[model samples]
Target chain A: MGSDWKVILCYSITVLYRLWWIPIRAWRLPLKNGERYFQDIEVPEGWHTSAEGRKWWRRYRATIIVPHALEACGLMAIALWGQWKQLPMLSLVAPVFVGMTLAFIAWWRHANRARIQRPQRVAVSLEERKLRTYFSWSLEAALAMLIAASWAIMAWRGDADIHWRWPLTLTYVVIGLIVMKAQVVKHGWALPANRTAEYQHWDEFRRRYASRVLDRMRFMNIVILAGYAAVHSLAGVAPIGAIRGAAFAAGLGLSVWMMIGIARGETAFLRGSARSLLPPATTIIDWKKGWWSFGAFMAGLALLMFWPER
Target chain B: MYLTVDFEDKRPLYQQVVDGIKELIARGTLREGATLPSVRQVAGDLGVNLNTIATAYRQLQEEGLVAVRHGFGAVVKARRSDFAGQDELRKGLRAALTQLVLAGLAEKEIVTMVREELAVVGGKAK
Candidate 1:
């Protein structure tokens, strides 16, 4: 494969991986809130019955999924336009991938809305709300750093072609940073003071909703880890030109281990029935830890990209 | 109806619900023969378990303010005829005064406070 194509392939693969991992990111946000946000939104009233539900859906789509889809489409368009000047078969893949991507987005939106509309009990406290916001931004920052560093290394080493893709990666990082900063401003840089009345209300909500929230997180993490494993395995097997085999190996191992840790933590929380005991701030801290680990993992991979074993 | 249940209030949700309803009955928000929303309806509206609502309704039934029909819903069975009477008001005021006294308030101070409160309520405090 030509150098240009390697760049295109790398960008495509990274975008696809990130897209698949979205649910994992989404799940982590609520869990990060120390399971408080989960209890809040999962309450027995239909999603349509509350103002918060509508806000959640709108922000989720706008801040996370829409930006991702737009970036994916833009990257794919650039790839196809590049290929159209040369290979027709490559152009064909673009339309199919784009269509399927849009379909998945639509399906996800519909399913989430339906789920929200169900009569579920949610008990949420201010502390939990703060945690949710904090962790979500942290996760985005971590993922964006990983993706950006991966692309940076690829560009620096001349392993991937399109230099223009740098701006898009930067945009993701900037957006993530802005979100995190916004959370800091909103939360006054401290965990909420204990409101016993609200805490009691939220405790009841958590007791009912914790299991479902953990299950959703586990399912999403499993899917993302599996997809990463499959794709990386294929990349290894294929006789692709200039494959950063070691970096890919390290990334896959770390991703799998991270997913396992997430599963283990979720299981422990569920089995111990410890959601009620754990403060909502703890969820944000755990989520922040996850992001730190993710950032370190990506940085490690980027290092590998610099010194490849030929 | 406004409903609040305090989990740490050393009172069960059902008991709290019952107490709230009793207060309503005492205050005459629930009139004699007034139909109450069904247990299922209240449970759905409050986002609580149906059993919680049932327990509250049962407590109200025991108090004779509510009666359950076979196919219909719980209905107010009796009115607290003296709910608004001076004796009942005095008893309520005495209960309030007793609570304050128990909390270390002096009787003379409470009497003076009550007189001033009455003056203010009567719009002659100025």
Candidate 2:
């Protein structure tokens, strides 16, 4: 514990920096990052110049900036106090994150409400909508299988009395998650303030982009949960300590990966330059990346499935 | 697929939906095998009742322009002009021609207009 003091201090400072950065970024969204924002959202041409666009921006700014600023101040006060008083500062991190998240939700809901009553012409694109459009079905299926097989193996070599508990409880939970993922994939959305035909196209593009990001996040979560599950199931097994360490390290690595994935979007926003909203067609089959990940996951599963008996 | 509902249109909402979709099919915008948005999706988008969109889809299915299968939603079957019998088409054509005549169009003018309308509905425009 004494030797780890420097690392702990460094982590707390990083957390404090991130907490301060969130609200500052949120506040600058309308000013410093405005152009990048337009690029990411692909607002229709002339949207920024139109009267309705100006009005919508006013409402949007008020909704986002004020609440976020207040939330940031409250978060910083608590975090600073915790740090100075030598209290358990890590507990403050989750509250700061949650507060920032809720602020985002509040503004998004407000923007959704500001869309005109009866959007009049609702446009769906010619192509069929599917989760597979944004996420790889093969990857999802592989995760489900990996989770089930892992839990089953854990059950098989169990302590006899409560061996069935994790498998039984988690199987239903996994099923529920898959269903929820399907439902939430392209469900309710906040339409852009500009609702032109071109904007509808942009909206579809935005939806797919957001869906892809969200699917990766969901996939990462399942991996993390499965890692924790693996840790629990192998807790007392000596030979599996290496496996356990790898699982734990992988969990932390993927948590950072997911955060970096989300932060990539924020970095694009803050870059203050227009990046192309339309990713070229050829790169889309990047769904191939999922198959690769699934293959690696399957390999790990194979190792674990056979390792138990040896 | 783009859809809109007018509060002021004298026609029933279901009829408007049916006609709008039929026009889209005629224009070749909705091609064979393309999936139509679900009835619930169209209804929610247009702020109309579910039955209105369902009736539109059912009418499309009966006309052979779309196939509405259970659970899979509706899919475009084909651009089915043959489904409309000759006499039924003539009656509608005669009413439109009569309106043009009442507006004092010359024979050449009426033919030109007919050609233009036909071209707009997927025929080759001269």
Candidate 3:
């Protein structure tokens, strides 16, 4: 494929993926609500009506999600512009990522404002806040490393085309899945402790998984770009052609294996009986809606597979 | 000025704050007649709303652990009669004993065990 065609294909995939995220984002708000209401049966003492308790929720939302959304948009713009034009994607993505990251720094200030503007009690606990912060930072660090590594791979292989490296992409996807599962498991375990604080529970689950999955998907796109570079570099060699063919076959095999594993794990998780293990203030997410959304995403992926790049 | 709140505890937040102040008074960290930080100042320092600290101070005032002046802010008044330096250790022991009892330890057995442990510690001190 010519360079322009490659750029166009990249841009198309980015747009397609962004479109897929729109429905998931819309679903997230209501799903969060459902989880909160469901988990509110047994909240711990001192959570509701406490000033610190109220502030925890404000910090969690403002510090975690708002900043994450801004960062994701900035990264998407970079990835989009880089592929659409010849300029370096990192230069565009990095500064914006830094700028958007300021939202988190402003979290405390925002929390104070929120507390003054609305004096309602927030139900999230200090322990929960610490856990969420740890997970959020870990995800952010992993994503940064993944992006840097992919870009480095591109720079290292200069003129050499690298085909879609399924292993690298799969690694990130697996990490995202693990993080999501861990979050859900945490919520499930916390259900019994403080049931009245279900809203905090649901918010934590959404905050952890949504940004995580989105970031990993963005990382996956960068891997796909690297693959595109590889394919373009090897347009003429007989031996390299044979190797590329084998890799493509292996990639397809691995993707299938991962899909089955993920589906099975999700099924088992959803089938298990619900336990009031989480704190009452925390929310327990409804797996039914989330699983349905996942299925929809998979179907979209299938369509992308058959879509003509030309 | 260092403060931490644990929301999961069954005790009310106001009670927790009062307990914390009582400990400070017992330890002489908050001396009699010493003015305490304004509720808003303490609340901001702890990342909590001002009302939480105010409620805590109110409880302390009711218990005579603190006296809230009109403009000067809350002040340490009289410490509890048992507000000696060893309240934390005593409180911890009481909690431990309660847990043991709840776990089915007989009262007599708990008393005997406490006596034995106290004897051991007393011997070491001597």
- Top lDDT prediction, candidate number: 2
Question: What order do you get sorting by DockQ, best first?
Answer: 2, 3, 1
Please give the distance, in angstroms, between residue A74's alpha carbon in candidate 2 and its true position after superposition.
11
Query: lDDT of candidate 2 vs native?
Result: 0.55
* TM-score of each model's chain B: 0.62, 0.82, 0.62
lDDT of 2 at B61: 84
For model 2, residues B16-113, the per-residue Cα lDDT tens digits are 77777777778877777878767755554444567887887888888887889765568888777446788999999999899999999999999998
Query: Candidate 1 overall Cα lDDT vs. reference?
Result: 0.47
lDDT of 3 by residue, A7-121 (tens): 4444444445435533443223212323432112222466534686465445444433554476466557756665445422322332333333344334433444332221123
State the displacement of the C-alpha of residue B58, model 1, in Å, after optimal TM-score superposition. 1.1
Model 1 chain A lowest lDDT segment of ten: A119-128
Query: Model 2 over residues A1-310: C-alpha lDDT tens digits?
Result: 5434533443555455466565666544544424423312334557766895577566556655555465557557756664433322343434344444445444543454333143323333333456676667787778878877676756655444443433443454445445545544434222222333554554454455455455555555566556545655665764456765566566556545655655665565445233332211101112233335434544443454334431
**How far off is residue A166 in model 1, in Å?**
49
Which of the two, 1 or 2, has more lDDT?
2
lDDT string, candidate 1, A1-310, tens digits? 4445534443455445555556655434433433333422333446433686556555544545555565556557756666533332233333344344444444444454443332122221212222343345565566556555544544444333333333342343334344434433232111122443544455334433433333333333333333333333344454543234444444445544544554555555444344444344322122343346435544543454344444
Worst 10 residues of 2 chain A by lDDT: A278-287
TM-score of chain A of 1: 0.31
Each predicted complex: what DockQ? 0.02, 0.18, 0.03
Best by TM-score: 2
Range of the 10 consecutive residues with the lowest summed lDDT in candidate 3 chain A: A115-124
* Position A102, candidate 3: lDDT: 40
At residue B122, candidate 3 shows an lDDT of 42
Compute each candidate's TM-score over C-alphas: 0.28, 0.62, 0.31
